[model samples]
Target: MWEKGYQTPIYLFNKLIGLQAVVEVVSNHTSNALELLAKQHSQMKTFVYQNQLALDYLLSECCIEIDDYKKTIRRLAAKIKKVAHVPLSKGCR
Candidate 1:
């Protein structure tokens, strides 16, 4: 690669640090499709009530976090939305 004499591992795609970053980016974007979809609060699934119920039961009953998961999901949803190109079907604040 002429004129591209030497590039650091971080600069190269799919290489060590770059690979980790790539994986993280992908993971963040695609963390739990069901959960992410629920976060969208789409009308198709009644705001994804099934997924919400399950998450509510799990987090509240299993982990004992009341309304915490909602905040967490909201945060994660925000992040996922920022990174992933998902079409939001509802208004998210």
Candidate 2:
């Protein structure tokens, strides 16, 4: 879930970078449009950096959650196994 949620923005940022590259290629032929595309490209680059930071943070959090969940499952399994191995003594119902 976390991956899906964060991947969209990262993907979009990559597309933006691609688009900026294409714009830059065209900007080489037009002096007037170069300045505008440059500004937008700069802002997009900043957003890409920020998005990367956010994705890193989200990945760390997801890792922590997965680790904790694995630990809990192991603990529960051990407890269940121990109970299953215990002898049933003769006692009053």
Candidate 3:
């Protein structure tokens, strides 16, 4: 899960760097400069949105895991409370 989750950010970083290189090369005088720029802009927008969606999905999964863990802790807390008059020790006392 960790590996998959980090893939999106890595992919986005590489794409941005690659596109920036392309933009720099095309910075010189050219008749289709505007057209090329427009295309790149659209492509960049798509890439950004796709990466965002992937990240969002990963975050949602992480949230679900967090909620699950919270529930488990709550359940354990309830069990501990039932078994003892005082709460669990704060440290290894």
Top-scoring candidate (TM-score): 2
The per-model lDDT (C-alpha) reads: 0.55, 0.52, 0.51
Model 1 alpha-carbon drift over 4 Å, by segment: 1-14, 32-34, 40-43, 47-93
Off by over 4 Å in 3: 1-31, 61-93
Per-residue lDDT tens digits of candidate 3, residues 11-91? 877676667555544443232444455456566766777776788797864221111233444445445444433322466
User: Per-prediction TM-score, please?
Assistant: 0.29, 0.32, 0.31
Instruction: Indicate the residue-level lDDT of 40 in model 1.
Output: 55
Best by lDDT: 1
lDDT of 2 by residue, 24-51 (tens): 5454444334444555656676677677
In model 1, the worst 10-residue window by lDDT is: 61-70
The candidates, ranked best first by TM-score, are 2, 3, 1
Flag regions of model 2 displaced more than 4 Å: 1-29, 61-93
Q: Of the pair 2 and 3, which is ahead by TM-score?
A: 2
Task: Please give, for residues 1-93, the per-residue lDDT of candidate 1 as tens digits.
Answer: 534634644345325445555666675656666465655544435445666778888788433322325456666766765665443336521
